[model samples]
Target: MMGHGPVGVEALPRRVSVPAAPGSCADSLLERDRFEWRLGDPGDPATLIEQFLSTHDLPVTDLARPGDPRRHGDGPCGAALFVSAAAGAVLVDAPPGAPSPAAGVPDVAVIVYGHGPRHHPSAPPGPDGWWRGPWQPSWTAQQHAAAVDAARTAIARGDIYQVNVVGHAAAPYRGDPLPVLARLGGLPGARYGGTLAGAGWAIGCASPETLVELVDGRLVTRPIKGTRPATPAGRAELLASTKERAEHIMIVDLERNDLARVARTGSVRVDDLYAVRRWCDLWQAESTVSASPADGLGLADLLRAVCPGGSVTGAPKLSALRHIAALEPVGRGAAMGALGWVGPGRLDLGLTIRTAAADGDRLHVWAGGGITWGSDPAAEVAEARAKAAPLRTLLR
Candidate 1:
């Protein structure tokens, strides 16, 4: 941060207290003036990522011990990729044929990027201001209920145990999306949150769940399933609800299997399960699964193993994904995927649930809930709205 002054953006005046949150929560972690990004080439997205890592060789830590430090928390130099819920991902950072900068922080040094420059960690920026824009729901409540019912039928027919059904809603904007992300992400309680601006497109993510994080050779993923409004009664209800617990455990088991596929034999374990955590106004049930990589396993393999996270896709992963494809009305653009940084030997990406992709005047936001046999279509729809409320308000 010392020599690394603001690189990508213009320097701003000294920070004044922000009354409202910024558009992108990642802004809270990084200095709006300082940071760098790369765009991808015509090569396959995953291949491009691998190429960048191999060429840059950013400083990475040793095999992670229990309490080792984490690197580049929301820095701009790393890549911010958005994979589709249906299957592929787009690298919104670092394209080939662009000015390639030196990879910073290749050592085991801890990098934190929310409050200031990627190199400098300072107080997160606060709100300047922006106008809420017009929003339109892609699907009516009835249509969403129909989708939930369809998933329920699939469950009853023994085709799947649980399926996450998501819906999309987009708002038209007139200005830059960076500010929108700043305000939305700045609201508070955003984990694995950040923003990435690519050519002709940008994504603002305030995702709370970590799809995967690599540190010191330890492969980890925290699958978040159940959610309830943040309240004393809501928290108790979430913990007591047999349905939520069952749905959460299903994803946990699925995640364990997903990890086992790439983890060193007997290295995978559930570090945390049925853990109640707060994110914005929701009480979420999150479980952490970690393992050492099997000999020769790399990031690409891990991404494939647990993508569009099981919590979002549901149990019997492949089957759930197929069902999701058949059921969803519109494609999940930036939501339901993963977003965050990939640098050096470390990668920390979040499940892109509470995220939006901004292309020109359109901001596509998506929300969904897992549909189980006991799921109530109306309630599921409400839960989806609740999950999406923060973004909707920001747009309003």
Candidate 2:
């Protein structure tokens, strides 16, 4: 699928100077050889974003607060925050979170561009970086299967329709993570890809889902659910699977409702449903939901309507969140939140799946799948493992 000029994953055109007024969305640190990032609160995130869109007539980009709101102090998630004007230009005040030399993963949210030696960035994970310590799974296969069973039990009782179950693994590491980010950001069909860092943390993402996008006065979102390994047989199976299709439709409907919350009346619709798209080695089922803003809607309002993304959280969002909180061992952190760019009359952000975080000596990676009535416990466990395989291979 194509878009208006170079937007979303296309990012900025290289060598473009930072605008004198710096209003162009794509003209920023991301397209450069190097840039700086750090942590500092931008007042209330919601309010700051609103001003960028309303008062200043500028754009503000950022990672949304994760589903588990309790992890707020981990460091301000200004990972992708870029403002159009100079006053807001210096988004973070702390020291820059440049990549360390050890070659680890990226964890905390840091902006890209500024105050670093310039060089042509490597196109992939330069041979040096990989997890060198023991890795521990937050939930082993048996444990994850138990969680899936619990979700299925709830479904039988009509307590929920579908839910996403997730697990994480951590390993010790050190040094810079930019090389890993470079490799991940180059993944095939990665629409929302980039890297950001902080004092001891950095986040690298190669996501395919657009949680929300507003451009040319229109709002858009691409929700992805079904997944299958990239193979002739696997692809065919994904297209014919009844359970995957049903779960996908339910989430698509949920996304339409979410977009409608902030959309102009009578302006919401599903532009694509059950669309098959390739993300790295997997073939995913995706759908697009779009609408125009309702009178008096703003960034804060749009975020409240949809933040964690339906495909990751599940349908009947609140219920699924409760289950996820009780079932998963740790919060989602910077992964599965949101990332991308923001510009004048344009806003684009994607779910941070296929994401990894590096904090000091620890590297974290997470993966999971949607569970429905037809979902098999064994299959669900396998799915999560399958999703994490690529990252594990790279880090190993």
Candidate 3:
């Protein structure tokens, strides 16, 4: 992970030059090619986010904070701050023969704040001037096939209903996150900036199905599990599908159990179940679970319990993780990991889905879906394609 000196908490004037066109900020931020931590004082995620919004002159209408999950025990410990803006002109596609970004920047940049360790020294530059790393998926077709066979075998034995196998791809870090994020677009309620894992950084274009919000000394977690095409005509059929509903319920149950471990007894409960939400190119089925902690459960503990999200992992999480480890080829890196902010008494995190990273000239985007006993390999591939479609178009 890349490291930098601690960011001072003193408020600075919000005087960033506006990009002439959308996504143009990449060129400026990348010119230096060095990562820096822009720190903030300890405060509630919501309040800090609001301050950012006001300071940046961002639109209030586009601002949103994750709701309270205390009543449902469904969210991370610290609060998160988020902001959205138009994605100006940016290139999402790779130009043929162009070099990747890895040659220019570090492989990974880990931000530190709150209660994490200090930054590590930056690594030597790559010979190519950009880091050149492989872009292999965590899971290969053969490995996926084997995992599916194992899952099927398990199902036949009636051990579990479904399992989510995750894969990873690691590349060198390019300069600024803005360029990658700009290609992601902000139309579909994209969030930017906040603390994560005790670090201050910005996450771009993350469409979270599960929102951990704080309300009235309580916490709420909303888990999104099922997804379908976002076309108008396909909407009804998508929501009516029983398969989607079943998958949604399984993850909901899993999330509740996770929260129950840290929440007060009888404090865990589902607030909303199987609700449909429409984004730019997809539709999702989501459920809201709430819980109140039994005093002493802090943000760090909550994060440790849920690092990789359950929706991305199948039921009986540990077994699913083992299966994923055996099946995938590369490390997921930050793909499925939570990214956001964590301060003294507040924490906010988002599952790193619908995100793209630059390795050098190559831009990497990862997508996958849950597989159940009824899953067809061909259909599973198709699901991944459907999920990647939005990102693919933007890149094009």
Candidate 4:
């Protein structure tokens, strides 16, 4: 297990540069090489990523914040990392000649990078029909409600503070799902929205929460917890709900702890607390936590300290993980993990909530929220559907 160490004063990387403006008229690097690895692969995946960035002179520019830029530009030559909640990760946009990160257990984790400038990744012309669905869920509404009840019981037993309960739904598809999935990046309030594809899988994300971001010596994370519909009544109800506020604070505290592991001793602090924000048609509560990173904060160490974000895993994260493993019907796949850019001294990964994954056979989506003793099983079920509604509508 990776240990959480000191977060003390440190200097920013000397070689780092601010990413290019959000939108500029320059060609972007196209895909060049592809690499995949699994959980038991020989090399440490995170370390390999650190090495790749170190040896390459990647450009530093492009969609720095959440959501896509209006146009393409001479963005940084970086790779896209799609880490599964379990299993491993895939790195896309890596160059063919880049150092081989790892070998063995070929398919589970993958990385594909870009070389010279290629045309922007517009939705290409493909088969006319792309998908089919009345989307089947892995867990029925009753089952999901039962899981919520179980979590509440665990809370009652003093076994955990809070645990996020997720439900999975999937729909069959016939052609490429990339174009439609790519559209997810443009969803309203998408702080970390975009699409990434590899050999047999792809991920479309419209996540509004920031998992972690490092730029110009400062490191930050924004975790979202409570949720309600985007309506006048909904906003009022969400703010009035003591239960929602309590759950939101627990995750905020968790995030502060996560960053403190790699932040300067007194640097970790909450910038904003429980600010209501909109994502699609939902109103959610979010908090911002940031810190001055410790010297020599490598990607491997940083990720180990905070990989599966606390908002998704729960407070008392380890205990929550055990509950999640026993309760969830299926693996989270790419949802609830981290997705975003990584460059020499920069990183921005969003908590992959409101995210979907597409295998050749099916496109999968996962949605849920934090569960506390005060949670209502029936409301939980409805909330999960409400969270998934936008993604489903877009895919349809």
Best by lDDT: 4
Per-residue alpha-carbon lDDT of candidate 4 for residues 35-111, written as tens digits (9 for 90 to 100): 45555466666666555544543422221222232222444345555555553222211111111111111223323
Candidate 4 C-alpha error for residue 11, in Å: 41
Pairwise TM-score winner, candidates 1 and 3:
1
**Model 2 agreement with the true structure over 71-145: per-residue lDDT tens digits:** 223222122442211111122111121222213222222132322223353234344634357778877789999
- TM of each candidate vs. truth: 0.76, 0.75, 0.62, 0.82
Tens digit of per-residue lDDT, candidate 3, span 1-396: 233212233322111211111122212211111122111223333233334333432222121232332321221122233211000000101111112212222122322212122233333222232233444554566666666677767766766667665433334443433333454544374442222211223233445544454444556677777777777666787678788788779888888887887677898899898887866677777788888865665443454344456787677666666555554544443355444443223344556566554432344566677878777766676677677667655543
Q: Model 1, range 38-62, lDDT digits (tens) per residue?
A: 2322454444444444443333322
Candidate 2 global lDDT: 0.61
* Candidate 3: regions farther than 4 A off: 1-150, 167-177, 185-205, 344-346, 359-362
Deviating ranges (above 4 Å) for candidate 4: 1-26, 55-76, 87-127
Sorted by TM-score (best first), the order is 4, 1, 2, 3
Give each model's whole-structure lDDT.
0.64, 0.61, 0.47, 0.67
lDDT of 3 at 66: 25
Q: Is candidate 2 or candidate 3 better by TM-score?
A: 2
TM-score of 1: 0.76
Candidate 4: lDDT over CA atoms? Answer: 0.67
